[model samples]
Target chain A: MKKILRTHILLFLLFALLLPSCMNEPVMPPNTNEGNFEALWKIIDTRYCYLDYKNINWDSIHDVYKTRLATDTTEFEFFDLLGDMLAELKDGHVNLSSNFDRSRYWNWYTDYPSNFSGSLISSSRYLGKDYRVAGGFMYQKIANDSIGYIYYGSFSDGFSDTNMWYIMNYFIDCKGLIIDVRDNGGGSLESAEALASYFFKNDTVTGYIRHKIGDGHSDFSSPQEIVTKANKKIQWQRPLIVLSNRLSYSATNDFINRIKASPNALVIGDQTGGGGGLPFSSELPNGWSIRFSASPMFDRDMQHTEWGIQPDIIDSLKVADVERGYDTIIEKAIKIINQSN
Target chain B: MKKAGFLILIIFFNVSVYSQTRNADTYLLSNVANTFGFGAISVLDPYLSPLQYNGIGLKYDNDNLRFLDTEKLNLSRQSKFTITAAEALNPAFTSLMMLVGANYQYGMYYHFQPISDLKVLAGGSCDVDFAVKYLPRNTNNPVNMDMSTNLNISAMAFYKLKLLKRDVQLQLSLQSPLLGCMFVPQTGASYYELFLLGNLTDAFHFSSLHNKRGFQSRLLLHVPFKRSNWHVGFDFNMLKYSANGAVYKKDDFGLVVGTTFDMISFSGRKNLPPSNFKSITE
Candidate 1:
């Protein structure tokens, strides 16, 4: 009986000792920000699933951060540091949080209009081609003329080869082609090159990619080649008018730049979105990834289009024009083609 | 006739004494139980023996050590120690048991240094490591690798309830870490070092109730799968750290095997000598 009682006491003591340790609380670090972004950064550096890009400086980057925290006064500076740190990783798919409303940028883009002078045909089919309508940009043929009129919404669908080919084919037999790229927030660069190839008979240098090294800079040329097996035949040799606006970006702007360089293509729109650089992605220690622009792209003319691409013929739109449903830009293109005929 | 009656009374008294001893053995055997046991063996040197008599068992074993890859950043090795104890609160209610366990681990890593900063803005050239070779320009030469330490202490309390005729056991555990820390450089120059600090600084605490409910039945074959006289089981856990706010967790399970000895005798059977045979016993 004494031995059993002793054993029970020992078990009770063990439970008493362990019970307190089980309900432990997380310890908050002293004098630190509410969210520990620094700690998150380390986690990414060590355990990211993949590491393809090279040239990461661990010490100097840390030193600069410490210096920034010590000397910087406002939260904006800290945000800038975070943004710059993310940019150093040089990937294009990552993004970070911002105090500003990114939605406002999209709203501003959707409200903008194209600057072209051509009237679109009312036929359901365009040059014997059909298109799917989601939200913006409708293409159709009009009666009494073989001209194809297209209303472009945005540049987000640059990765779709079918859409690019459809637009190109619709203008094959038209007397004049009206291509719309207004209010397009740029997407894929390869898509831009694919669309531009339809207009070129020979191989051409599309643009240059600028990468940053320490304090210096280097350039790599983005070359475009014609897809030989894509039924290499030109059915459209008519005048081509491209529509643009101030909201067009990266790939969209590149498309405009390529068309402007060609002799047969005419751009008629407002200034395009000034973003012409490729983005880079960085992984944070906290297991979150961020993306930002790391390089700028330039045309064959050595012209930097970071401030937005200007159209050959500038035609701005007013709010009243949208309410009337009368596209003055399309009307002007039709008039020009009619006069030439 | 009187002599014969006296002999009969003596025999009856002796029989009563023997019955009393047998009853005491049955009562004690019913109250006492062997709940669980655990053991493990690792391939990494120096070898840690699984036997408890060698002073290297589940409670005190620390022979194999490896780096904890948290966020793939700070590479460090941790030494862990664990001890577990359990008991039945009520012998009458044999289905209920209480378990308590404690775990402590200490880790350390060598120092890391950052080399160069690549400007990603404007038309700048991104550093190509294969094409360039450069060293730190700072006065204090970057430490090739210096040792840094971290520690984690955890404890758990659980209540296990047996159900379905003791075939399944359900356990509810409250777990928490008492100590957690990571060493950071004074100058704060390396991102890898900063990454380590973020993961190790927070002590994790939580409560989980789990049913280790598995169907365990005696097989009617010659295989060892037949219900054995003794059974043992074990659980292992692993924690992974990530810098980008992600966490990784892993676990391993093991079982124990042995024979059990019966402690009670029937009414008319004689008390046998304790089995001293070890070699030929199997």
Candidate 2:
């Protein structure tokens, strides 16, 4: 009996010792200029959500960038090279971070018309000193107190349901409400969803989002439905006008995509600068952090929103009008609201 | 196929113990030990980040060992409980992963005195374990949870000797899981889908010796002083698993200190001891 136990125990130990040999782990490249370059390139090639969707020739870009890499390249020069490679994707949401600088691609907004004039919005003709601020929204009556205009510049700021209740009461008598999201470079998606909830009349299918499921470029999970439910107590049943420009991006783009479905909503002004992809963070072997788009979002029609979304009514701001103390886009929005009312 | 073969071998080794005679009616004493450990730990949770993190680990353990009610004192039962926590940072010093885990085990072991100073115990155990790894960096997937129940095999050795006219005891114990079921979500699955959208699909997985491997070994030295025994030991643990093309790992090596004591009680499951067995709690 004892011999049997001994033999079993010996055999068990032998099996336990052999189990580790089965471990299969990817071999991480050594930390060098070439190694960091490969790591950064692979992270984008495998995980970035918009590569195939945007029709980017990533392999060609990689070939062009590889020739610029030198063994003695300084860290700063290496960062610049990688930043240039990322720019080929033409995405504002992609960035590379180091102690010295953060690299970004601004052509999404920079190459377009600046349809918004900050100085004009703050003038007495519009949201002057009387404009009250609540929940990151700057509000006052415009068009001779006939219309309500609110300038919300960022989604990073948070507000509560109580704030929405009070804001609704303030706009109760206006002909319509204008939400100007120009020059807003996106912050939190939840904030965007919350603000959109007030405009939705009922539970609505706003859009869809897909997450990367594997390392392959086209590998993604089934599109999950993004539903925007109405805020029962603070519903905005009045005519809603959402303003956009070349700089309206990221979460702002998402908000525009959702609120556009409202029965009483009209999107006006320039096409929104689009950054519809949600970014996730990663790092290279050299310890520099890489932020890339890891999830893709779509509109109700399953249309890709990576490029700017078209306004139902297109309007552009001419510097000649700003100089003449007349905000033409606001004038057009007021004209439309008055006609609708 | 390879995993199924190893699982059958483990089950065969454990099932042979019940083939012995069913005449187990002898009352016996139980020894209980409580230990606390603290040491350095390293973690690599690829779902959280590509970088590895290093930090300190803390664990607490309670063990109860007692011979079963048998005619001969050759079979013993053991119950153990352990809890561990660790917080670590990525190599870039930009991210942090906080982890907490707990486990409980119960098993029966066979004792064999191969030599005058050497006693070896081998057995199989059934255990349940749960753990959570939290990384605040990810926007959509912030936390990953692990829950599993396992069948395990364990072995222990005890050597008693004299040095400098003093009697001392040395012990080595090892345990590993052979098969179980585990929760392994997709590599980058969104928590928003699982929690907010309430879509829970393809998260639970059947784990075997091939995909999941773990082992723990503890060595202790007991010193007799003032008619009581106090022990200091080192514990080493390693665990690695894969599912949905993602691999996760956790490793710990720590030092522990504890004391041993004997206990006896008149319970429904335990037989009443005769005059030969002493009960301190009686």
Candidate 3:
């Protein structure tokens, strides 16, 4: 019996020792143009989260794009071809980056009215010379001091709760506040959620998210709830206006989605630029990296927010007003905050 | 009755081993060794990238060994701790992945001597390992952590001989993990939604022999010297597991150089050192 046991033990040890040698190394394509094309296609075919959601015929698209490649295509030509094919997804978050250039699909906002004027917003009529700044927020009392106006240009810029405390204290005597997020292209989702939490009355299930679980386009795990807990130390109680435009995107879109659910909050201006899918990146055989939407985020109703969110009040920048150093959207926001007061 | 007889036979064997050895050899010393190794490593974590990465690794290990029961010379214990770090790049040299890890293991072995020149030991061990892998270029999935605790079966053999007018020992040992519990988040879940937002459900799973297998083995030749014994050998490690729809692989082999020395600790009983055994502390 002891001999039998010893033999089994020795066999197990031999098996363990041999397994690493027997296992296959990870297989990847070579670094040719065709190899890179195949690698990029497979990465998107297996990992991109929105193929089935968007009803995109990726395999058919592959056939279409492959035919466009020439026998002697230049490096720039190949880059352009890849960029054009990616534009088919119409995602602003997706990009193909290399040492020379980056390809971006800008139609998500470029097709809409340029409702934002950088010069006009920073003019004497708004966010004037003495406008107080806290982190990413540029604020001053407007509408004859009855309303507080804050222009937050980028979600990428980090802000602390202490900054929020000071901003709230400065607006303590005001009737309402206007948060202009007109051209705030998104950055960190944590920043967006943190900014939204100041307005939440309690811990709220702000949204749901689904992650890819398999190679199949529709293979996704069950929705995971995203809860935005109210800042236990402080909460916004008065009327809050979230102003957005076609340039507000990604994390900015998420910020508006969470805050719009607050009973005391209203979204105004043009519909937001949508970039609701979470982006993940991978590499091609030639070493160029590709960013694509790999996770889909949704509102509390489980509805996709990729097409941008509608506003409670739609307004646009009138060119005539911009010539006079005034922002029509800001004036409209002032009127609404005045009425709410 | 047969089971009771078997248990008695084991106890008798253990006691008889002690009676056969001299008291000076059984009751007075412990062995400790420190080893450092450098070699190439190959890693393939599908969650990090589809391509396998190959690069250099550095490791440092410390082992403490002693008799578990002084009177029972056949029973012994070993405690080991190790730290390792590696950096690897993709085939195109466009991306880099870095991994740093630490491991600890403790076990006991029952010895067997079929011949006067050789000794064999079989034992069980428990170990814990923690590691982190980072890919600087991958967005939203830049980092993945590895945390696991495992129970393992281990064995070793020692052969004593005379070479070049000096006594030398050749030793071989293997440790294989059988069962473990590990943490591997669902593939494709962004860190923003999982960790920052505090969603930890379904992130841990039980890993068994079918899903996880690995072994750490070393073969060394120890040469006696005046102050301490110096050894040189090969150190190899291989670990791979399937979890959360992702496969993680790591294999490495390196040259190891180290020294082994014996230690003695007394509880103020004033035990005198045995003849030919010098104590520098004294």
**Where in model 2 is the C-alpha error above 4 Å?**
A1-7, A124-126, A130-133, A141-146, A324-327, B1-33, B62-81, B89-97, B103-130, B134-143, B155-169, B224-229, B259-282
TM (chain A) per model: 0.59, 0.95, 0.94
How well does candidate 2 score on lDDT at residue A126?
A: 91
Q: For model 1 chain B, give the 10-residue run with minimal summed lDDT.
A: B44-53
DockQ (CA atoms), all models? 0.02, 0.30, 0.42
Give the docking tier of candidate 3.
acceptable
In the range A1-341, model 3's lDDT, one tens digit per residue, is: 55764696689678888765544444678877777778888888888888877889999989999999885998889988888888888899789887778999999899999788888878877777999999999999887778888999898899999999999999999988889999999888889889888888888988898888888999887898888888888788888898999889999999988987877889989999989899888787777888888889999999888879998999988889888877898888778777876
The estimated TM-scores of all candidates read: 0.38, 0.84, 0.89
The TM-score of candidate 2's chain A against the true chain A comes to 0.95
The root-mean-square deviation over C-alpha atoms between each candidate and the true structure, in angstroms, is 24.1, 5.3, 4.6
lDDT of each: 0.39, 0.82, 0.83
State the lDDT of candidate 3 residue by residue for B89-145, as single tens digits: 877787889999999987777787767877877777778899898998887888888
Clashing pairs in 3: none
TM-score of model number 1, chain B: 0.20
Better of 1 and 3 by lDDT: 3
